[model samples]
Target: MNAISIKGLSVSYDRKTVLTNVYMDMEAGKLYGVLGPNGAGKSTLFKAILGLISSNTGQVLINGEPVEEQRKKMVYIPQKGEIDWQFPATVMDVVLMGRYPFKGIFQRLSQEDKNIALQALEDMGIANLRSRQIGELSGGQQQRVFIARALCQQADIFLLDEPFVGVDITTEKKIIEILKQLTDKGKTILVIHHDLSKVKDYFDKVILLNQWLVAYGDTEVTFTEENINRAYRGQLSILHRTTLD
Candidate 1:
């Protein structure tokens, strides 16, 4: 069965439609790139999939079950720019939050949970910054901290929104490597990416969107000039021709 399925999904704000009649079935163990021009409802799509917002007319299922029933199996990393770096938390504290799903509301984090959080930081190559305040870290370091937190969740599906933005090239490479390792272990990863130059190298499958589903499938086949034109209204036609040449 597909790891995630969306059917007739729609969302609206102030009676104006933001997303419409979206349909897709995302398979397991692959890296998917969600692409679109600005205002294409990319973030809205992620929100709908996670059930963070009410969909106007459809459902999202994971492993044949509603998303709420399988919440623990998924982890979402929002764009760094959306966060407040001034939050009074340490790197370790942020990572430990991932274990909250395993602990009830009143339960304190156990030593084992601390251990997992440390391991996650180590895996991300930021163990040395465990005690540092989150706001003190550099942009790349901050992104690593978030990814480490997600790793501590040990989730089957990872949805990262524009993770590479403002990060250094080395950090981007490291993140991609970690994602590939996750897919090798049968995990599903979806990334909201805007860098068209790297799309061919980073994703095996790509979903192109512009307030709706434009195309989705193998990166090589679905990421074509014609489909990109339809989604971008021919604005990126030259880019498509140049990139695909």
Candidate 2:
């Protein structure tokens, strides 16, 4: 079965349609890049799959089951802007939150959980900064902390929104490498990305959206000039100068 299946999904806010009759199936062990212009419903699609928002029509199935049934199997790393940097949390405190889904209502974290969280921090190369305040970290370090949390969760599917924004080149490269490694382990990942130039290198497949499903398939085959033009629409001139050439 596909990792995720969306059938006739639509969403609206205040009577303004954000997505319309979108359908797609994502497979496991692959990295999918969700591409779209601003206000193209990329984030909405993530919210729908994560069951954070009610869809106007259709359903989202995870591994052939309703999303609610598989909520613990997925992890969502939202955009940095959506987070509160001054929440007074430490690196370890944030990464340990991933284990909350596994604990019972009154259960306390065990040593094993701490070990797992520390391993994730080590994997992200931030183990030494485990006690640092979250707000004290740089953008790249902050992104790594969240990804470490996802790793600690041991979830099968990951949804990351614009992870590369505001990060250094080295950190960007490292993060992609880690994501690719996860795919190699049969984990499904979807990223909402805006850099058309890196799509070819960063993702195995592409889901082009513009308030609707435009094109989705292997990057080399589906990410063609024509499909890009169709998705970006009036933003072609800007993309041409920055990415498409």
Candidate 3:
């Protein structure tokens, strides 16, 4: 099944093109790594899919419906740097926000919602930190909280941006394990990632972008040296040494 479909997608900023004529059909129950250098429009693609940005000439469909109609079915976890960690919110408070989508306009969260949030925390091995301030936790713990929130929401598609940055090795392993488990249960996940070394080990497929859809398919076939060279272009020498070391 196609979880996401993009056709003739083009995005621009200040009269400059960011993503040009992009088209892709992402399948369900797969983990996809969105890879490209800085300013490659990787984030822009995510924004377009989430309806956070308007495209110059294209459409994004989620589950064969428009983005607005399917917003609740998707969960986006941006980079840690994008968040205000000192927002005076507890772990539980953040996780509970996921349930708001399913509530009536004036409805208050019920015990069932709390139970679901608690279970999400427990599953992430952070039930003990439910009362901790969001800013006080370590980077890894903070990432886990957001994943827990996604679980609480029961979203079918997940869009995560640079999720493994600034995290401990143990936490990275834990996160990949959790993501694989989600895929096993038929969840679709797309991650904007920079680490090329872990591409094969982590994702079932990859989307290589460089202001366009350079290549996309099963990792074994699409993440080859030729495609990577095409995608990275001028930074090949640096990326090859650093990523393939």
Candidate 4:
């Protein structure tokens, strides 16, 4: 079954139509890339899929169930700057927060939870950053920390928003590797990537959107010049191409 399915999805902010009728079916166990220029409603689409916002005219289904009730299986990573790392928290504390769903609101972390969080950091190659204050890291390091937090969630699906925006090359490579490993194990990944150059190597599927659904399908067969022209008005689409070597 597909990991996510959206039909006739639309969203408006203060009466301005930010997203128009959009339809998409995202499969499980593959890395899908969301490509578009700024103001393309990429984040809004993410929010809708997570039920963080209500869709105006459609339903969002996860594994054939409503997203709201099935959120337990999905992990979402917002853009890095959205969080104020200066809020006085250690890396461990932040990553461990992903374990909250498995615990009562006021419950303390279990030994198992701690182990999961640590394992996530280690798998992400940032175990050394566990003891540092969150705000003390570079942009790339900060991005990895959030990805680690998502990993700690232990969900079957991951949705990362602009994770590589300001990260360093080395950290980006690590993040991509981690994503590849997870999907290899049958995990679903939907990532919002701003760099249009690396989409080819990073994602198996592509959803080119611009406040509306322009294209959605396999990367090689779907990212044609005609479809991109409709989405970006014919300007060379940012095809963030990369390959794992």
Candidate 5:
């Protein structure tokens, strides 16, 4: 079934166009990768779907319902560099914030919520770092902390932006393993990744964007050399050369 449907999505800032007439239908229980050149409005598309930014025209539906209504089912993990490392919070505190959606603004987090956060940390293999300061962790550990936070939310859809940026190879592999496990349980996962080499290995579907929807479908079908050339415009020619060699 289609877990996400984006139709005619267009976004602009002060009358300057960013994304133009984009459309895509993402299926459930699949790992999708959003690939494009820099400034291709990749992050803009995510924000539009999340209603974190206003769109000039179009609508995003999750599970056939308005995106707003499916907030609990969707969780976004932004780039680790975007987060302030100096934010005086512990690893446990950061993960527990995911439970905020389930409570009133004035309500406090319960012991059960804390337990859920701890378990999420354990699931991410960061249980030992629970009491450590967020800023004191390594890049991979920081990434795991945010991912654990998302797991604590128990959302059915995960939107991760540049998750493997500066992490170690082992950490990246671990994260992918966990993501696949989540998909096996019927959760949908979308990742915004820059590396073209890992797309086929990591995602079942690929959404190639270059300020618009260039191509989107099964990885084997849509990630053709033609589509890559069209979306990346000669910038990814090395990928073709490497594949043929």
Candidate 6:
């Protein structure tokens, strides 16, 4: 199924165009990486897709429906740098926030909800840090906690921006493992990544972007030296080894 369809997409602020007439189809049950350099409008593209900002032109459809209704099945894990690190909340408390969709304005959490949240924490390997305050966690721990929060949502699609950034090697591996598991379960994933060395191994496909669509397909075909150099806006290339599977 086509999870998302974007056509003639364009976004600008104060007459400065960030993305030019872009069109793409994101398929279901696939892991797609959005590759771009700084100021490449990758994050802006995601925000537009999520309807965080209105686009002056183009139409974005999710699962053959308007974006608003289909957004319920979507989950977003923002960049760690974007989060308020000083928020006075515990690891468990953060994970519980993912369950907010299941609650009515006046409703309280049930025992089943609590158990599911705990299970999600465990799945992300943060069960031990349940009681720890969010600010006290290390860089890697913080990423895992955020991922745990997303897992608790159990959404069909996961959109993560710079998920592996500012984390330890161990934490990076754990996050990749969790992503692989999601792929195994047929969950569609879109991740904005900067690291070229690990891109081919971590992602099933790459969508090279630099304020425009460069290439969209398998890494073996699209992540070529010439393509990467052209899309990355410099002397850089995607290193290919093998898929995560």
TM-score of each: 0.95, 0.95, 0.95, 0.90, 0.94, 0.90
Backbone N/Cα/C clashes per model: 0, 0, 0, 9, 0, 0
* Pairs with steric clashes in candidate 4: 196-238, 196-239, 196-240, 197-239, 197-240, 197-241, 198-240, 198-241, 199-240
Q: For model 1, how does the per-residue alpha-carbon lDDT over 94-200 read when each residue is reduced to its tens digit?
A: 99989999998899999999999999999889999999999999888888888888889988888899999989898798788888887898989999998888888
lDDT of 4 at 89: 94
How many steric clashes does model 3 contain? 0
Off by over 4 Å in 2: 238-242
The true-versus-predicted C-alpha distance at residue 159 of model 6, in Å, is 1.5
Residue 137 C-alpha lDDT in model 3: 97
> Where does candidate 4 stray beyond 4 Å?
235-245
Better of 3 and 4 by lDDT: 3
Query: How displaced is residue 128 in candidate 2, in Å?
Result: 1.4
Task: In angstroms, give how far residue 73 of model 5 lies from its true place.
Answer: 1.7
lDDT of 5 by residue, 5-31 (tens): 998999988888889998888889999
Cα lDDT of model 2 by residue, 114-231, tens digit: 9999999998899999999999999889998998999999889999999988888898998899899989999999999988888889999999999999999999999998899899
Q: Quote the positional error of residue 210 for candidate 4 in Å.
A: 1.4
Give each model's whole-structure lDDT.
Answer: 0.89, 0.93, 0.92, 0.83, 0.88, 0.83
lDDT value, residue 91 of candidate 3 = 100
Model 6 / residue 106 / CA error / Å: 2.4
The TM-score, computed over Cα atoms with residue i paired to residue i, of candidate 6 is: 0.90
Candidate 5 total steric clashes? 0
